[model samples]
Target: AGDPAAGEGKVAACAACHGSDGNATAPIYPNLAGQNVAYLENALKAYRAGERGGGMSMMMTPQAQSLSDEDIADIAAYYGSLTP
Candidate 1:
């Protein structure tokens, strides 16, 4: 919902896994590009809260747990701004 430019830096690490544009290089990683911002935000919060899980959750759970709400917003905005 905020300026997508502000989120660019916040997503550097994410680029390694999700690609700079949020399109994943592998099928194992879910593509984040062009997803709804609200959905991304909620999913991150759910992962952080340990309310979602499976084998794949291990990677996201710890990452999301360390993210602040602002980070979540920025990251969501960044990916949501991209073209899926």
Candidate 2:
């Protein structure tokens, strides 16, 4: 699994849109907080693979591309730990 503490430091880029606590800063951005880890991981992996398109795919794909599996897991953990 992943360590929330470790994930915290890796989410600086994500915070701009997703917020530090997994909430979205803008209504157009989806809230990541309180989402399941599996869903978060799968969605990010899909984005990285370019399997998911539309909406923010153009932006998300590039962001996810630089994340390793461990990074994904950690990020998922961090976001999952938050309350919606």
Best by lDDT: 2
Per-model TM-score, in order, reads: 0.90, 0.97
Model 2 misplaced stretches (Cα beyond 4 Å):
none
Residue-by-residue lDDT tens digits, candidate 1, 1-84: 545787887887778788989888788888999999999999999999999999578888988988889899988998999998
lDDT of 2 by residue, 1-84 (tens): 988889999999999999999889999998988899999999999999999999999999999999999999999999999899
How much does candidate 2 score in TM-score? 0.97
Worst 10 residues of 2 by lDDT: 2-11
Whole-model lDDT, model 1: 0.87
CA lDDT, every model vs. true structure: 0.87, 0.95
lDDT of 2 at 73: 95
Compare the candidates by TM-score and give the number of the best one: 2
